[model samples]
Target: MVHPLAPLSEASAIPRVRRLSDRHIAVGERWIFSAGFNVRSDLADTGRVDVELADIARLADAGARVAVVSHQGSYRDGTARHLDFVACHLTALLGRAVRYVPGTVSDAAVRAARALRPGEVALFGNVRLHAGEEANDPRFAARLAMLGDRVAVGGFSKAHRRNASNVGVLRLLPGFAAASLLAEAERLRPWSGRDSGRYSVAVLGGTKPEKTEIGLVHLASTYDLVIPGGAVLNALLAARGHRIGASVLGGGGRRCVATAAEVMARTDRCEIHVPRRVVVAPAGAPYSPRRVVDLDDGVPPGHAVVDFLLSPWARDRLRRLAADGGRALVAGPPGMPTPAGTDSWRALGRYFSAPRVRTLLLGGDTVAELPYEGPASTGGGAALYQLAHGTVPVLDELARSAAHMSDMPA
Candidate 1:
């Protein structure tokens, strides 16, 4: 009989191996564990064991050769810090030797791994280079498995994904959850209680409409939904039959609008809010105040809607809704980048800066552009967060949200 938690397809394909050592081994009992930086803002203050230098030391001292895999660029100062900490601590702890794989796992990474002795460890560079990693290819899983005897998945933030590292490899080999990964899973488990004083609100914004649609559908059922940023707002407008520019549409904008419409039709309990007023730039021109359109009027073609107009009515509504204590999630930038003197960008910043809103921000452009002078947080379905967290489950959550909303009574 197959293991209960294992997927039916995987279980049928391969019988579950009883012991860790019984599975397979290319070298002296290797244990491959995946890790990533804790990017969540709230976790920073909670005195968590974030797989720091000491953590690696402890593992090395226990005779486990450590292999660190991260997608972050070496040029980035942050990546340097993580590498420095790992290298310094591992060297100090091992006191003999260490090896580093400088680039992403490919033929090169495989070659490097093959060269390692039974007891030696090899750290592969970023795993994101292979498109199969995101697609959760079995071949990729098999390749990754070649590096270790047993797999210990510790990237909790990424556990929700069925990707190669998070799921595929687990199926192919004996799998164990890393301590930190288990802890994060446990932390989120209590969130099932509706009255846990932990209601979450997500602000969905991104350039990709499909991703935004999926993320919003998921988050909307479990938490309050706040929609911002030009792309998402435009999609909302398009769903309502407003005329967005053909240029934008051909460039992956139409698909977003279509996804939005589909989502709006599917979900009932999740409230989808669009901006009351939108700043639009005429085709091939930077946004100007003269082109701003109220949602009461239809959007014109050959124009891009840039920012949410925080009118008194909208501001009052947001402030009132946010007065109650709960978490707020913000994704994507509030507006498109405009000319330096344009009011679109400035207005977008002001909307985010408004009082009475406690926000947990996610996505790269959203965090970079918006002047959100509050406690910042990061968690989302973007490729950046996927690489950072080492998994992508935002899409799954989005699908679940849509289903939950569909089940709600009208």
Candidate 2:
């Protein structure tokens, strides 16, 4: 099924083409680099080329003039010190000089770009600081376009959006997907086939619903959905007429629920599951045993449900369903303070991490909360399991896989 977020019209499917000669290069040459820079435990093998300081070093060593931009300043001091560490390591790896432009992107950033000769590198401050970046404003797109001669998109994590940097800038330049982008595409190729099944399950819940909504809509037709956690589940429950106390509308919360419902309506087979019981607490109190309430029992005013409470029967049913080797997608944690005692969180951790279960954990929080103590794989423990001896599609590469899948003779 076509992802809801996919462009309605298919653009020319451009196989990633490598520029072989400077003739292919244009004057005012620049390479616009961005990375899905979030604190992810399983990012190394997920096909996203996380822009690190070492990447800066590598670009510098190649003598490839580069300019970097991102939505947010990832590091505390704004120096991106960890990235700098990687850059320092890359310098040692390549025996080359690397330079980073300090401060966020602004008119100064534009001026700095103009000052650089071909082969020099500079990193701009977070792109997210500008509201237009997320809004996909044309003016912002035009401004970013000036930084590059040929834009090379390296950030696959943000590939689902038609935002200014990811898609808008591509329209104006001779652009191509970067090595990381291509690699991500190739990594998730297994899900394109018809045999992948229509009854797919997506485990959805996250601190940021807006980001998750993009991925969910894309995969909706391919999966039957499951939502967990205080925010996502609450929104879903609220949609079904359950009062979830506070609203989940801000910070991409409401958008997620609305998008999920749209996908479910479009694909008739979809179903959303919210917890039958929730652990609630008074507005300002810590989660305590006395505060938990059954949804059927009704919640008191000024109370919030903080976790899911599964009965033995429900746990058994979920376990049985998961154990059948059915396709499942897990995103977001089932509960907050996941390390804190929460039965639903523990149950989900056990169910998804079970060897017999065919589970794909999406989003950052889900992976971090997994109980596994050891380094399992580069794509995180859950991804490695889904990709282990079988194939699981990672979202960063969805576009490429969709292209390949659409090409099969039906």
Candidate closest to the true structure, highest lDDT: 2
Off by over 4 Å in 2: 1-29, 38-59, 73-98, 103-108, 114-119, 186-200, 211-221, 224-227, 247-267, 284-290, 311-317, 372-410
Candidate 2 residues 72-142, lDDT tens each? 33222343222343333334544554445544456776777777776676656556556666677888878
Tell me how far the alpha carbon of residue 379 in candidate 1 is from the true structure, in angstroms, after superposition: 3.5
How big is the positional error of residue 13 in model 2, measured in Å on the Cα after superposition?
A: 8.9
RMSD of each: 10.3, 8.7
**In model 1, where is the ten-residue run with the lowest total lDDT?**
6-15
CA lDDT, every prediction? 0.49, 0.51
- Most TM-score-accurate candidate: 2
TM-score of each: 0.63, 0.68
- Distance (Å) between predicted and true CA of 256, model 2? 5.8
